[model samples]
Target: MGIGQGSATCGSRTTCGSLDVKLRLFSSIRKYYLFSKDTAQVAFFVRYMSSQGPKEELLGLLPLSGQTRGEDIANAVQKCLEDNKIDLNKIVSIATDGARSMTGKNKGATTILQSKINHEILTFHCIIHQEALCAQTFPAEIVEVMNLVIKIVNRILSKALYHR
Candidate 1:
């Protein structure tokens, strides 16, 4: 998404323009043969203002091996930023799903990342995550109907003519 103007001052040694990064993490279990493996994936999207105007783009998708602790998540993000040659001081804010590993006060990814930066960065829980949590409170009957509708839609979309 296009972010606001890049007026934030850079605290690092470099004088590059400021940027705002949004981070989202997804964890799942995949079955390979008879064994199941836990996998974690992270997606980073950055917004910055260029000469023309505001711009946003996907930085990269990183797959984490083994356990996805607060430290692991933070390191993955740090590596991505470094690989892209983006300075840590340019980060104006970070948005996460509010998971314990991401939001934990002492060792959360955001907390750790903030410490690495010279200036304070804004942190907030994603609204989509909040909506998903609220959806869980929906009545069973309503949820069932929604699921049935999704199935019907999927079946229709699966057909070539219907999809077209």
Candidate 2:
């Protein structure tokens, strides 16, 4: 659909002043979402600690409902927070892939899900933007290497992607 870009909102408020208390440093990781048109497929997340530490899989989301909306995601996340005993007050920020769905306006999933539930939770975009920045600064040789890798991956996965 022409890569329509939009975010989401929840339109709710968490406990008072809870946001200021949490959302310090963002997760040193990345958030990924897998969705089939009009339905959320999966949400894959990873958090890295330092440069050498093991990575954390925040969630491999298969939402309870086969068809999930932004609000559904928001509420589910709230449940996860409580179930995992993660105090929202302690969370400083979130790291997402910066995709439109993850950072949209009204229609974006993130905006729809967090409208009021978390007014102050700071959301961060992953370093994908940085990767683009790096490309701009790269030497021709480095660019060639990157392009080659991408071509190889595409060739290797074309069938799989097409089938899907």
Candidate 3:
């Protein structure tokens, strides 16, 4: 659903049954594209300002669908909130799996989030994503022969042997 509240509040669901937090379009890691230009990753983090807890609890998913641009991430976040009838002012901070497109120097999702939400929206880089980025930053060269050898080894192994 696009960013907007439904007539039924999230809290109402609790009284009716359970606190059903509607989720966004989900995808499995194995089904994800590793480095495809057609895809982008998007993530959002939320914390309730209410010390008493919230009508809807926040969620921090480890990996999000590929969302390459800041606008795309912002749109996804907004959409999620709207679908769940979450009050932006009630949000405290947001921790995300930092992607440059989402956390760039300016006009990034972090900065854009501040603009979109009157509440304090703090964007933090996830440790895991950061570590992965660090690992990718090192300058190294892999021998083509070595890569071919690994491919051959992979071909000999079962799919179960691949962790990801």
Candidate 4:
């Protein structure tokens, strides 16, 4: 699903159940067409569990200039929050990959954001990232097999040769 439009509470309890409800923020940096040049931009997203299961929305993309320090990520997130008018308090947690620029001890994006939002917002490394890390522990043979299978599947799908 998608995030509700307009100014609505992000993690409101749905009628489905009284289970834990939270708004999750996810982000990533990627190359995008800007000014006809390939540039790295950080794209932010918001996610939450709803009655229909889960929902997410693309917050915004910030141009990454020079080194992407901790403060840079914090500023990008703050600008996104301001532009979208999303209440900082409503953000129950932030999920990001375990990058030094994100979860560093002294100066990190999450730390900087906590200072700006004035709350110890719950944070964690992305589950997918954790799983990938775990996968690295598998034997090289298994990893190679998985990679080969992935490549074959990707090629088949890209060529529209896969039926069903």
Q: What are the Cα lDDT values of the candidates?
A: 0.82, 0.60, 0.61, 0.78
Please, what are the lDDT tens digits per residue for candidate 1 over residues 79-151?
Answer: 9999989998899999999999998999999999999999999998999999899989999999999899999
Separate clash counts for every candidate: 0, 28, 4, 0
**Which of the two candidates, 1 or 3, achieves a greater lDDT against the reference?**
1
lDDT of 1 at 63: 74
Q: For model 3, how does the per-residue alpha-carbon lDDT over 1-164 read when each residue is reduced to its tens digit?
A: 77445556645665555322222223344566666554444434454446776644435332346645776676777767777787656655666666676677686767777787776666677788887778575555535655677898887885555555
TM-score of the candidate numbered 2? 0.42
Instruction: Give the distance in Å from residue 18's predicted Cα in candidate 3 to where it truly belongs.
Output: 14
Residue 67 lDDT, candidate 4, scale 0-100: 70
Ranking by lDDT: 1, 4, 3, 2
**Model 1 stretches astray by more than 4 angstroms:** 1-38, 140-164
Which 10 residues in a row give candidate 2 its minimum summed lDDT?
Answer: 7-16
- For each candidate, what TM-score against the reference? 0.61, 0.42, 0.44, 0.63
Model 3, global lDDT: 0.61
After superposing candidate 3 on the true structure, give the runs of residues whose Cα lies further than 4 Å from its correct spot.
1-67, 133-164
Residue 93 in model 1: shift from native, Å?
Answer: 0.7
Residue 56's lDDT within candidate 1 is: 89
Q: Model 4 clash tally?
A: 0
Residue 113 in candidate 4, Cα distance off native in Å: 0.7
Write the residue-wise lDDT of candidate 2 on 59-108 in tens digits.
55746465355555656666666777865454445666666655667755
Q: List clashing residue pairs in candidate 1.
A: none
- Compute the lDDT of residue 113 as modeled in candidate 4: 82
* lDDT (10s digit) by residue, model 4, range 1-164: 77664434434434223343222111112234335556657778889788999999887878877778888888888877887787776777889888989888779998888876756689989999999999989999999999999999998889885467
